[model samples]
Target: MSRIQANLLLLVIALIWGSAFVAQSQGMADVGPMLFTGVRFLIGAAVVAPLAWREWKQLARQGKTPTATDARHIGGLGLLMLVGAALQQVGIISTSVTNAGFLTALYVPLVPVLSWLWLRQLPHWSVWPGALACLVGAFLLSGAHELNIGVGDLWVIASALPWAVHVLFVGRVADKLAAPFLVACGQFLVCGSLALVYSLFMEPVSLKGLIAAAGPIAYTGVLSVGVAFTAQVVAQRYAHAADAAIILSSETLFAAVFGYLMMGDRLNPAGFAGCALILGSMLVIQLLPLFRMGRHKPASVLDHPV
Candidate 1:
């Protein structure tokens, strides 16, 4: 797929995830965050297992075997997912949804920074301005009038590091893995298992709460985790992590739109401006590469269509 197509897939993921924010909020109302995360991701694991099995069988037919190194990479990805999700869930309980959403998007800028530090991949020139715009847009979309670093905000901020790492890891491993579905399944299983273990030991969990949050859990697990996350793993193979992160940051805008549609929450002028800025960032990021490539011959893989 082309970079543009990959970006479109990520945008769809943002939409699905954004709309599911309400379900996440409702799910947390009756259950501990850890327990809720465990159950929902377990559901996601179950939903994706068959697809992973099919991929495994195809690889087997092709005489390809997964190595221990592949297992280790998958495990690492899972651990990153677990850390980011746990922190976000805990932070969500202590912060407003708007705060959680906006703060989580700090990963947009963080992705490029992490990539530069770990992978020695400098972000495209466009990424700096695009990420900045997206961050500001996310803030406005969140409807926060003041910047306060609460415990929850701190947790969310910490979570962004793992999330940024996760995006880079996905981009790295997606090409190495035989099938992205298997990577998704493995990560979900690991993340879910970790959360389940933690919930059993530290959190109050009950079958009753699980049943109470069944609808939300199923929606998030099946659609958001299973489908959307798998799309991310597949798409990132074709897109720059920094660009993908900026695109996904538009989730806050989608969340605002969904909030208005589902809960009768109205967007103020700031929210509308936020929406415009995010869209503008996307356009800039998309077209800037093309313009630069036109002026000068392509110098790197990213300069060409995938």
Candidate 2:
């Protein structure tokens, strides 16, 4: 797919995840974070399993089936997903969806930095300014000025690193595998299995709690995990990791909107300005590359894998 199409897919993923913040928060009313996370992802795995199997069969017919090494890499991605999801799920118990949304978005800035540090892949110059804008926007949008930092916020902040790594790693893997559904299914299975195992040992998982959280688990598992995350893996094959992060960071804005509509969350003038800044940053990053390409300049990080 074209880069623009990839970005559009990422945008839709952001919307799904944004709205899912409410489902996630409500799910904890009956279940522990680990249990909720585990059940939801297991549901996601089942949702995608058939598609993954079909993809695998097609690949086998072409003699391009995935290898054991691919399984290990995908497993590593699952571990990162679990850590990030667990931290966010736990953190959301004490934090408002607004705070959790923006705090989780801190990964937008971290992605480019981590890419540079770990992969020696420097993003386009525009990405630097765009990322800075996203950071400032996330801060203002989070309404942090009105509330003191709490333990939950700290956990959410800590989750950003693993999320950044997950984004970068997803980009690399998607580029190589060209099998987004299989990657999505494998990661979901791995994450779900590990989380369920952990929850069985540490948390009390009863049928009543599962029934109570069934609505949320179904919503999040089917839409957020199954659809949105699979779309992300597909989109990252064409979009740069840094650019994808910037685009996905718009989830904070969508979360704020959903929170206001569903949970009575409010935003001040500063919050609106923050929203504008994030939208502007996304536009700047996306548009700058087109202009650069017109000039026949060297391909930027946005146009190539990074």
Candidate 3:
């Protein structure tokens, strides 16, 4: 697929994820975060299982042998997914959809920073301006007027690291795997298994509660995890990781819109301003690369290696 097509797919993923915020928030009322995430991912795994199996079978027919390193990477992806999802689900319970969405977007900037720190690969100079904008926006969105941060917001912020790592890892692995669906399935399976273990030991899980939240669980599981995540894997194969991140980050915008329409969510003036800044940052990051590419002597590629 072309990069533009891949980005469009990422945008669709963002919309699905943004729409899922309400479902996830509502699901919390009837079940614990761990239980909800566990069940939701299990459904996601099941939804993708047929495709995953087909891919695996096709690979086997070609006499391809999976390596230990591949298994390790898949395992790591699942663990990262589990951590990121758990924190995000729990964080949403105490924060507004607006707050959660903006805060979660901190991952966009964090992605480049993590890349620099962990991989020793410096991001394009343009990243600084966008990252600065996002940082300021995050502070403002965290109730800068009141000079306080919500606990849930903190959790969401903490989750950003794992989310960034997950995206980077996915970018690294996207080209290495022949079966994106199979890899996605492995991730969902491991994530769901871990979440289930946590729910079983620490959270109270009831069939009645799961049934009560069936609509929400189904929405998040089937669309958000199953379809959106699979799309992400495929999109990343054709698009730059940074571009993919920026496109996926539109989830914040869609989440805010969906939250306002569905849940009567309203942010104060400062909060709105913060959201605007964050949106601006995303646009800046996306456009900077185009500008650089147009120059006679481009300084660096905006799409840095993952």
lDDT per residue as tens, model 1, 86-124: 898888777766667788889999988887787677877
Report lDDT (Cα) of residue 65, candidate 2.
96
Query: Which residue pairs show backbone clashes in model 1?
Result: none
- What digit string (tens of lDDT, one per residue) describes model 3 on residues 1-306? 765677689889999998999899999999999999998898999999999899888878888756778888888999999999999999999987867877787788777777678877666667777777766675565454464568887888788888988987685675676678888888999999999999999998889998999999999999999999988888777765555666677787678778889998766777677778877877777667666565643322223432
Each prediction's number of clashing residue pairs: 0, 0, 0
- The lDDT of model 1 is 0.82
Point to the candidate with the largest TM-score: 2
Estimated TM-score for each candidate: 0.93, 0.96, 0.89
Report the lDDT tens digits of candidate 2 across residue range 1-306. 888898999999999999999999999999999999998898898988999999999999999998988999899999999999999999999999999999999999999998789888887889999999988898899899777889999999999999999998886786677688999999999999999999999999899999999999999999999889988988888788899999999999999999999999999999998999999999999998887676675332334442
lDDT of 3 at 52: 89
Would you list the rank order by TM-score, best first? 2, 1, 3
lDDT of 1 at 182: 91
Off by over 4 Å in 2: 295-306
Candidate 3, superposed: residue stretches over 4 Å from native: 135-145, 267-275, 291-306
